[model samples]
Target: MQKMKMIKRGAASVAIALLLLPMADTAHATIVKHYGVDWSKFQGNNGKWGYARDDFSISQIGGYYNGYFIDQSTYGTQVSNTIALNRRAHTYIYAQFSGRNQADQMLDYYLPKVQTPKGSIVMLDVESGNPDTDSVLYALKRVKDAGYTAVLYGYRSFLTSHLDLASIAKQYPLALAEYKDYKVTAEPDYNYFPSFDNVQLFQFTSTYVAGGLDGDVDFTGITENGYKGGNAQAPTTSTPATTTGKQLHQDTHNYTVKSGDTLSAIASRYGMTVNALVTLNGIKNANLIYPGQVLRVADSGQGSTVSQKATTTTTTSTYTIRYGDTLSGIASRYGTSISALASLNGISNPNWIYPGQLLKLSGGSSARTYTVRSGDTLSGIASRLGTSWTALKAKNGLANANLIYPGQTLYY
Candidate 1:
């Protein structure tokens, strides 16, 4: 196995204040765009998930997303990763954590990684019966601190039963979801609309249902209602058949899932829902989606699963992460786990690496921080540092300092 690596740079002034700011970007160039969709397996007779031959040039994708799914504690990584990729859309995503717990890190995780948001707009879920105004406000404050624009995602009854919109509207955008022009499903879910202190993204009606890409997509493009009133807005998405058909026919199946296939953007693209798709595919979570995996268009008429063209290949025994190695290949070469690599060190996910990333399996792990490259170990490091393996492991929280990773730091 290769050693792990760790890189530490001086914090920029902007980074220090990032946590407390609202709507801040994590990456230097990533943009924010809010997106939504009817969310199903198949595109509406008119909508699409993958790129089609006719309307490749433009689209307004919607994913099957809701507050409860977004806000769930078990779904933080799932939500954050989706939000990160969808930083390219221009529609509001109604995110909700599963439970309203103070211990939940939905606000913290999202705020810290704002640079990748597709849409700069944010809408917090205020469950209809939820009375926890303080917790909701805390999440909102984090949004402000991150420097992102804010809105409240709720129906009229939810507001009447639980929220005081007049107060929340004082500072944030209130996304009023008023169901109309609709059919009742599961429960007697109706649209909402009323006078409120603030209103931005109002849903006058939602017949558009993104059925996880498995069933027919309920499209709003042909309808007179949705996001905008009949024939409303500047850049309305046109169905493939009706538009001028200038879009390139890139088969949706061809786009392999690289590290970039975060759930949010794809769900938005096809106007399907995230959780429904995630659940349908049996994905463990959002962060774990990997390259080479062909993402099916949730429904798209039940074809065989994606198949990779078979070729002869040789498997290498093991690897040591070099000073400037990328995680993509190492994870592939060893077929080792990404989470394992992360856990071996105190490394968080997706950060770039630099010199001396000590690879745990190969070696490294002696100091408070050590950049393990190809090979390192507690015994070897301890011997060199003139310390005991027991002492070194204890210094860090390693149950076994022997399990150090490349680029990880040792005690100074």
Candidate 2:
């Protein structure tokens, strides 16, 4: 663990005000491109602390800094050297890991190593494919709670395919790592920007030899002048009105526990993790929800159960098929079974679904189409729409059932 001191440098200026402004209206200022390196590039640079790939000293490489792996356990092997190097370079520290509770622990361990000036970022490298969405969310929340300007870093596809970025995109400035269809001619050309609401930084490539390291561009204009400190106040997050002592009925809101519902199943349906559900609902025991228990399934604020504001508005009973839809996933979302959906739809095969297929909801309304969202599987879509993957594929004329893409539609 490293000891970090927060130092406010210079009189508070307009740049700091701009940095604190909400990102909903970030001006598309001509982004200044910068270059830097991560610990992976430092590996084997020098013998004992050969964790870096290249032996070039920090001052020699130049540009913005995002350094080291925080939760690799073996990261300590290079901590002494990394801290010493960062002290000379004043680089931002990144804490990379995949556990909700581990976020605080790792940040704690790395906090002592931060010798940089105050307001330095402690970005969370959120690339680990942890199925538990809440783990990352809670980890982000934990990072902010610790008074660090927590940023999220991962490739665009990985973020969309594996995690529900929609839940947290607005709150955290995305540090996207996307490498596709571009030659590294000089300053890298980033053709693919993430769909995240706030993109503060873009890491275009890990092979930018110009700086002999990974390449990044700062959109916030903070990194252009070098590392001036930024505060760690919590980012804005959406909070659903709470409902007390009643079952939730909003489409993506409250959920009623069914006979076969487990914490994992219910959490998945609402795009959350089991541990998150437990923490949100304050369940004394994770295995103790009853068949009729209504639980809160959204938001990082308030309790796990909806409060006095739970609504009774009925949602459309049918779901449209989107990319990444899967039979098991659909069933989990709707609190129904794949077999029931297959039987209802008269499908002989369960493994064939396509986009543009409509599916019936649990209430058995006319089949409706659902637009595919990132991280959606046919089964997951089926569960949410109260249909089966076979039914979805058959309705959409999909023979492979396993293939789907975003924006494609499906029927029940």
Candidate 3:
């Protein structure tokens, strides 16, 4: 927004002012995040992996991956008849269905002929095989009636006590599982599975690029609609029990541990990494597993959780800072603390808060100011605007978290 003019002629005065701003762009994307071996037998003969189309290249590095389903045991003696043929990553397959005729030969003989390409996404790194719960909801309704889109990958208490990725993402698409220095977006939404209304991806770096078949290949981000980008709609009022509600599409499977259970209550029901369900079940202590054991789950997602959206009438308020909000990370949201919010809205050096300042957040929600355009920052706008940089510096009152500049404005 831009407009400013003031004049004084013969008699006296005239003024015109209207400046509303926020837009800074810079971030192009094309990710690739695959994990080691089990690439349906990945093996560049030696560059290391298991077997895709050989001579490695994986689209020369830009497509992106996040798999790691080691030993989906070939579903039927062996698989992977085609893969990486022309290099294009968007995968997230991770298998393990066991019985119900191997989940009906992976939903009617190998998911409607595996040929991926056309906004691709297929899932079920189900942190445990052995059907029950109606053969994993009929193999996720046969990969969503063979059109595609279904993810339940586990880790974090075995994906919330069995499975409920926002109620199976309201019917498929919830992929979240990573290793090392952890981060399925720092879990906590009942262990993990907050909303993008069914979360699409967040495998986060698994390692082992270049293709094979489709075993270890999660790494993905490419978002336009769904993914861990979070906060899409919903939130109009209360949401900070750390957020995680809404998603009950028929109470997602209701089983309680039997047959001896406990790879830690099946990896905490469903948040998983009993060593990736003991490497998709071939086993080696997740404390020697137990019960009817059964396990499998994967997510090596690399990147892709895009966002720009925010305006249903934008609602999470508590703001008041006007005088042209200092152009950097702006001010502390509403609860106050950009140095007590520029000293309770007065203005000093906490980057001199401006733009009609005033914040308040005990319960009267109203703190909206999101300007930082031109390809925003604060860690890719807290990974594409879902949010996080200590909650955008405690809602924007940064004393210095790596200070910011170039036209700023923030408030969650």
Candidate 2 residue lDDT tens string, 1-412: 1111111333235333433444443354333333444444244321122123222112111111122332332232222233323311222334444555555555555655532223334466656445346766776665566555556777867778877876667566567776554444234343344435566666656555533445565555433221323111111211111111001212234445544456765665555655456645768898787755767665332123322221233335677765546665566444356786677666577667656777765664333456565567889888877789888865654435566544344555
Per model, how many backbone clashes are there? Answer: 122, 61, 92
Name the regions of candidate 1 deviating beyond 4 angstroms: 1-87, 90-106, 113-115, 184-192, 209-412
lDDT of 1 by residue, 26-85 (tens): 322222112243222223322333212111111112211322323223222222222222
TM for every model, in the order presented, reads 0.33, 0.37, 0.19
Off by over 4 Å in 2: 1-35, 41-99, 181-185, 210-212, 222-412
Candidate 2 differs from the real structure by a C-alpha RMSD in angstroms, to one decimal, of 22.5
Local lDDT at 64 for model 3: 12
When 1 and 3 are scored with lDDT, the better candidate is: 1
Q: With candidate 3 superimposed using the best TM-score fit, by how many Å does residue 381's alpha carbon deviate from the native?
A: 41
Against the reference, the lDDT scores of all candidates come to: 0.38, 0.47, 0.37
Residue 37 lDDT (model 2): 43
- 2 versus 3: better lDDT goes to: 2
In TM-score terms, which candidate is top?
A: 2
TM-score: model 3 vs. ground truth: 0.19
lDDT of 3 by residue, 131-231 (tens): 24456667777766655454555553466665444555555555554443332221112122222343334443343233222123222332211212222
Better of 1 and 3 by TM-score: 1
Worst 10 residues of 1 by lDDT: 214-223
Could you give the candidate ranking by lDDT, starting with the highest? Answer: 2, 1, 3
